[model samples]
Target: MSQTNIPLLSLKNISKQFFGSTVLENINFDLYPGEVHAIFGQNGAGKSTLIQIVTGDIQPSSGKIILNNEELKIHSVHKARELGISAVFQEFSLVPQLTVEENLFLGSNNTKGFFLDKKKLHQMACQTMEQLEFSIKPEEKIINLSHAEKRMVEIAKAFHTKPSIMVLDEPTASLAENETNQLFSMIEILKKEGIGVIYITHRMKEIYKISNRITILQDGHVVNTDSVSNINEQKLVELATGRNITNLFPEIKKQRGKKLLDIKNLHISNSFIEDVSINVKAGEVIGITGLAGSGKSAIGRACFGVNKIEAGTISYLDDVIFDSSKQINDISPRAMLDRGMLYLPSDRRAEGLIMEQNIRENISLPSLGLPKFSNGFIVNRKIEKDIVEKIGE
Candidate 1:
């Protein structure tokens, strides 16, 4: 094949609208074989919308999608998969109750007769796991797997399709550094096999490391597309945000105050945390770093009332929030929030926000029952709108 040949996948003049509002406009993108094409943008920059159109989850209002120089009319996800396109979205679609093998071949049409060939399925699943360097067992249930393990299974499932074009949206958001390296290695193997990978991520470092070409999107339009070497990180950020980001991280010089939170001899039953002690001062920032299964996240959960503290003393600014020595009931999450202690869960979609609710509803959820936003049991529309707008700002 010549370098001047048709692209493996070409999106020409793609535009999408929702309820008369343009979400994507005249977007032209291409994915070439054996190359990793990265799509970069800020939040609501139409990155997900563009990906949905490609995966047949949403149809574009105007444009043509060419696959191997032929215009393709992708009506559904099944059709896209059948036409050698596969995607591993950020939110995994695995059935938690199903085994790894079952989830891997759940929607596949490769079985013979009415009965499922367990032996064949196991063999194929094992082969795919081996190819992707995944370490989970085929018989393991997804519910019992860790976040990183589930992410690996999702990737393995997508790779098992043997698609010529692959789309990975924020694949490493939940993965650790070592796990991310493993995924990058797998991407290299795919590239060698002439698979065109469309990688979407907000991390700037990964783009330079894994992508051959970069496409920046701003306000539902393609700002620029160029070779990785042709654009520096600063220039790339500027293009995506449409502004000169001179200092991405400004210097902070603030004096610390008295201890605000004090955790003493903390222990979570049947978990990794044991006899841990920590203190946080007001106006101070702290970071927790450890291996994937470490008790770092557990500490946050315990402090936020998500995990029970079997033995500990949690004092907030001289006030005893939780004292395991006392025979009292555990504090609820609502109580902690009412005390002005909010915990932002790592899994935003599942715990932090309601996915089905709109932005206004999500923002007002915490204060729904408050007197300022609700009269008796009815919500004050003006107050709710004002609260959302203030929080959004």
Candidate 2:
């Protein structure tokens, strides 16, 4: 049978429940070889849950998975990969201590006699990265690389598996415009190679650019599945959110306060950024854009005192906190936080949030010892919960 006649994978009546709460209800989806199927949904709309079940990260409460027209019961991510299902999600699945080459073949049994051929693995990693069109060092440790570089390594790891079905969740979330273009090119290549792809992204343009079909999920139900050409961006948004785009983001007006931050002649140590300057007002939103590894994040990290500043002047509220010329660089993250400045890193799993902690705990961490959430190191659970709930609202 041809690839179009027979689906590469299918899910029938897939239902998932966590502690009596239904996540996915009677979900049915399919992918054909060489097809780019885009899954669209709002947060908690069961998109991630369905993908997790397909890739074996989570099991469905009741369902049937058919792979190549045969029953499939994927119980683990590793087993899924071995069975020609590879995935790279927003949360990177990489060992921080391991090098890129090691991470690429981390769980695979591509060795003999219970020993790994490190040299061969390095060569293979080099070729794989090249094939993916990513400029990353195979010997570099995941922890030492920047957020974008780490994302590239994750993409390379998934692509190296040579899987029949590849899952990419927010692949361009950490990537630059040029990097995103490269990824789109890679997707075209995958389509030609007859590899089915399950893409999950929020970028509306990507749906028409790469995906052949789109499936929208809303409140644990399959809202609709149709060809990309059949749906417009506004229609997709309405279906996914159950509201018009205008209702989702209503117009709001705010008065601009005095200059809040000013960066001039910024230069990051060991990076290519130099002679960069930016000014931000209280109500203004500043966006930094460039190619991957172009120091877009370097500027933010420098302001937060995470990256070393070779030469720069960072002024907060007209006070020079980081001035390389005056040797006045005694700033730290804690000091900035104490000054009412909070910095949220790009990598949530590695930096922003504590993965082991619950959502309430993570949100309450910043104010753990503060008067609102605690009293003299003793936490006030009720008060903290109220404040967190209010913040959520």
Candidate 3:
């Protein structure tokens, strides 16, 4: 079939429930060939669940999936990939210990009869990387690759088989400015090749720049599906949040307060970062913009006590002090939370949210020590539900 004759993939009234709690209700969606389809929503708006169902990682409770006119019994991820559906989820699936080529062809090692063809695998990975215009060495271990390089490898792997459809979930979340441009160029190449792309991103600029159509989900339901040319970024954000958000990043007046943290000198390994110094003020949001592995997250980690700095004097509040000599356990993530300092990690799937845990458990993870719960030792499930509903708002 030609790219425009029929939708490469379609979902019809797909509804799913976990323990009788409806997660997706009457969800109807479609992805046409050679088009960049964008899905947007707030957290817990069923975007991830719908992606899982489309990728066959989980089956829908009801409704059918049609891929090229074939009804899909999406029971396993293997079957989904075989049917030309590939997803690069927010939580990267790359194995750091393995080389780039090995990670690319980790499974389903295409063989010459009965033996694994290692040479062919390397050749295939190189060809895929070339298609994406990446210059990564095939023999380099994933651990040695920069965060941006790792993300590039993930994209190259997605195109390894030259699948008809590609689903990217926040693929550029950790990327830098130049890397994002390169990735966009690659996405454009894919679209030109008549491959359907489902791009999920929180950034408004990406939607405007790449997508041909936009689909908004609000409170686990489809809110709008319209051509990108028909809707602007302001309207799309309104549809996703169910409110007229004047500014996604609310402006706040800067008040010169006491230095909350002062870092004298800092250095990191693997050439991912170099000598860096900064002092953050109380109630000030210091924006750090850089490519992947430019030490934005590393600096956050060193400040939060997760990473070990080679040399640095971290002074806090002009009184409290934290030096490089301190152990990793000294500034526990929970302790930081208790000290009115909390880290909202970038990896929402792996670091922020627990997929296996239900809504209640995930939401109540950080505030379990409140005195409202049975001497603060036991959880009051009722209070927890109220907290989730509040935060989810």
Candidate 4:
């Protein structure tokens, strides 16, 4: 994509302060038409704040947002959309009870005489999804859609407005490899249509894959801005973190220990794994890597008793928790956890932890029932706090 010299959108001397605390300091950035300008940063690097300013979710304390060489004052998201600007944030903003078409045109003038124009809505939804090359039915309920499909719906909603500039923040956070490729294809389509994309992500691979220009932001400050080809992966990491990862990595020691977990002839029904065998030893950091739907998560879920095994032998330290041939199936999540085997789900917000709880509460939640933290039923706050603090550290 060949971007023009004049930027479609520009943030000059942008600085934001909340409660007298400076979050963004003199940030200058640009987004040219038909350009994928990526912003790389660690957590608290003010990426969200910058996007919020661009989308009119918040106003900057100082700086000017120039659109097409003209000054623009965007006070809200509605105004931004009206000005040919749109954003697809990391969080999904769809109602679970609503259908895809309904969520796509939500808050829009899709009604005729107080009645929803279903045919027109469907046509528009399908058209926008076709443009994005996403496969999802218009009438499907949002609750029934998978994470990837939900993400696509969000993007489709944003793209339906036909914005000149689009902001995508961590768009591939929950998507699989194939789904990510699909998103990249859509981005390419956007580029061809002369839509300026401000992509914010922490993934280095994505930066090299799609972005034309890379801007590194560290501690809410712009460190460097250059072409992706000009900066390699190692250089990118150092620019983002201000340190080399090789110096932080612990030395690998070649030592073997007794087997802690052993699985043989594992077969999960309705999954990609037909026959799998693996052994985990003490003091071993085993990694099970595969593409989307390639049985990596299946194996972990099966070991945690979350997924039923059609045929397999799962042993934990010589204790046969599950053996299909022997007709012995006593595997349970509680049993696995009690046996010192833990599994973290892929969707942390939905399955792993309670989003409403604070960090201390979430950390102590799983250990509340243990003897050290609880006396029969009541929890010991002092002991729990002490343990939780150590675990947090």
lDDT top scorer: 1
Predicted candidate 4: what Cα RMSD to the true structure? 3.3
Question: Model 1, which residues run further than 4 Å from truth?
Answer: 1-4, 326-330, 353-361, 372-393
- Which pairs in model 4 have colliding backbones? none
TM-score of each: 0.91, 0.84, 0.82, 0.85
lDDT values for all models: 0.89, 0.87, 0.83, 0.88
RMSD after CA superposition, every candidate: 2.6, 3.5, 4.3, 3.3
Expressed as tens digits, the lDDT of each residue in 67-148 for candidate 2 is: 9999979999878987899888888778999999999999676685789888889889999988877788899899898767
Candidate 3 off by > 4 Å = 1-3, 112-114, 245-259, 264-277, 310-312, 323-338, 345-393
Q: What lDDT would candidate 2 get against the real structure?
A: 0.87
Superposed by TM-score, candidate 4 places the C-alpha of residue 62 at a distance from the truth, in angstroms, of 5.1
**Better structure of 2 and 3 per lDDT:** 2
**TM-score of structure candidate 3:** 0.82
| Model 1: pairs clashing at backbone N, Cα or C within 3 Å | none
lDDT of 3 by residue, 95-206 (tens): 9899999888887758888987889988888888887789899989998987678888888888887789999999887778888898899999998888899999888889
Off by over 4 Å in 2: 1-3, 96-100, 112-114, 118-153, 246-254, 265-268, 310-313, 318-330, 356-358, 369-386, 389-393
Candidates 3 and 4 compared: the better one by lDDT is 4
CA shift of 123, model 4, Å: 1.6
Model 4, 13-75: lDDT tens digits are 899999999999999998888999999988988889999999999999999999999998899
